[model samples]
Target: MAPARKEKPIHSLFAGATAGAIEAFITYPTEFVKTRSQFGGKKEGPITIIRDTLRTKGVAGLYSGCMALVVGNSLKAGVRFVTYDSLKHKLADKEGKVTPARSLIAGLGAGMMEAIFAVTPSETIKTKLIDDSKRPNPQYRGLIHGTASIVRREGISGIYRGLFPVMMRQGANSAVRFTTYATLKQFVQGTMRPGQQLPTAVTFGIGGIAGLVTVYTTMPLDVIKTRMQSLEARSQYRNSFHCAYRIFTEEGILRFWTGTTPRLARLVMSGGIVFTIYEAMIKAIGGREDEQ
Candidate 1:
């Protein structure tokens, strides 16, 4: 008998990265709006914020941190997909079949890696652009230009202003998101019984629930990340921890969840889209395996 073909980690990584890049590119303006709204103020709504940002910063402003977003999101997606697959396989080997909890664990590991390596710098640049309409002296025309400007002015350290909060938020967010999705999928599959397929509406419903859960759970860390990244040199808070402490002390606990409304909305919409797309991709790829 022929040896069984093994799934390649790199293939999954590349595919996920490509998908993530596309998704990020498409939704980056919303992300820009989300970040700005998160850090800016409670007064202006999302639409108003977007309008003001475009009026002041123009078209380029909408895509202020495109490069950083693309690169960071790509790496994050690559690491997340690859790590999740590898860890799931290993866990399955030991425990027999893959389970939702196991998938969550895998996602946690992937999220930590991505947060530490990919989220910090990109977020820093993004936050700077969003918070400040004063186009830097020379004006950072694009992501590359902005990154270079940050590096030149602030040194290597500047690129990671909100590293800690990002790590904490994304780690927990990814874990819960993946776990909920996995568990929900299992629950849906179970109801259907042997050889049954879950309906599309059911899939979307489960994904939306998982997304809401993650957003609420990770709101505080997300607030801290946005605040830290938005800081200027003249600003008080020096780092993520300090920012979190200051916000808690000054603004109280509720301050940490300032943008919960928009964030929850964004998470629900984005999460549903991402999972649906991921499922579709997996099915397409897995089908080829079955045919072979």
Candidate 2:
């Protein structure tokens, strides 16, 4: 008889990339509204923000930096899942099973990798889009023009303006997210009947909860990253730390969570979708050898 086929690394990467892309597209409008509400500083609620933006900029405006989002998210998810799987396997071999601590380490590594390779430029464009929309006289029209303007005005370095804060936020965010998911999955599985596999619904629910926790916990750093990256187009602050301190002092503690409502909602939906798809793909590929 022929031997069973092994799961390819690219399969997981592609799965993650595809899932991330789909989720991003589905939630792009929400994302646009969220970004505007969070960073635009327009004195209005989320619904009003969306209505006004669409009224002025139209549907295309809602997807202003979608290309950047797609490319960035695809790479981020691909690298994150691939690295996370690789690290988990290596750690499992050495330590014999996944633990929260080990998962945290894996998440940290994955987060750092994504932050360095993907988050900076992607977030920079996203921030510019949000900030520019609030501008009295906007510079670039959309994603393409915004990208070109950044390159022409400030060069490549400008694209990675908030590298440190991005790394810090994402690294901690990943650490918390994956570690919580891993630990919680184990707990949920342990509580189930013998030989029972974790249900898809349960996994999605848990992942959503984990994502909300991570996003909220690390939201302060995210605010700093957004402000820092947005500075590429304008002359507001000097660096990430300075920007953070200024916001904290000037805007108050609540300022760090300016648009947290949309973020929480986005995380709940996106996190559920991404993790559900990821687990489904892993199962479809017959990756799990033994279920608890």
Candidate 3:
């Protein structure tokens, strides 16, 4: 398979969107479980959550805010790769090599761009819908209805409630995820012949490892971001800082990892699927560095 970075930004964007759409649809149940688990206690474990959601709302309940997430994540992933490669292309040295610092810079910029443009609003709507699901009379019906209700009641700013923490989480997330994946891929390639492409399984393994590394590194930020984006956030917390403070004080430090298991499960699968599909797509496109 071709290195995804060798693809033109437009091709990467298309590959990424395709990868993200498939990944999001497949992994959305885990995401619903993760969000629901974040606000629930130990008693509401993954199995219990699934059982409850299925019992009350059926399988559709598990996909409560899926469309929003699918669209948002697809767009986010596309922009993320495009922005990362574009910036990396600019920052690469004369020999077409990018240093660790430059790689980090590119990843950070990509994550932030995706956060502002795609993640914040979609996440806010998703979180609200998931939070609403627990209620006897769920206020929002689906993505369109949920988004409309949020905007009507709270205006456009409602959709961007968790902008700061989302940016922070995404920044740290992509920075660590991309860097770790690159380093791990480079290490694997170094052990092989020059220009030898990695096996699909190996690429998936590396991506999963990178995702595992990212989850622990930024779980706290994710916790904060979830809380801030939830329906009750306006009444419960003042801002991102206050949300962090409350979680640390009232909820206890370990509570910040409340939904780690589900998130870990989702991201590990997500990283692998996204990268594997992306590389395959890029390879099929027959992309090379000069095209950029």
Off by over 4 Å in 3: 1-5, 40-43
Encode model 2's per-residue lDDT on 220-242: one tens digit a residue. Answer: 88778776766442577777777
Instruction: Provide the global lDDT of candidate 2 against the true structure.
Output: 0.78
lDDT of candidate 3 over 104-197, digit per residue (tens) = 8888999999999989988998899899988999878888988999999999999999899999999998998888887788778879986788
- What order do candidates take by TM-score, descending? 3, 2, 1
Q: Which residue pairs come into collision in candidate 1?
A: none
Report the candidate with higher TM-score, 1 versus 2.
Answer: 2
- At residue 282, what lDDT does model 2 achieve? 74
Identify the superior model by lDDT, candidate 1 or candidate 2.
2
Number of the top-ranking candidate, with TM-score as the measure: 3
- Evaluated at residue 180, the lDDT of candidate 1 is 89
lDDT ranking, best first: 3, 2, 1
Model 1 poorest 10 in a row by lDDT: 283-292
The candidate scoring highest on lDDT is: 3
Models, CA RMSD each: 3.7, 3.6, 2.4
Count of backbone collisions within predicted model 2: 0
Q: What is the TM-score of each candidate against the true structure?
A: 0.84, 0.88, 0.94
Model 2 bad stretches (over 4 Å): 1-7, 40-44, 93-96, 134-138, 193-195, 231-234, 287-292
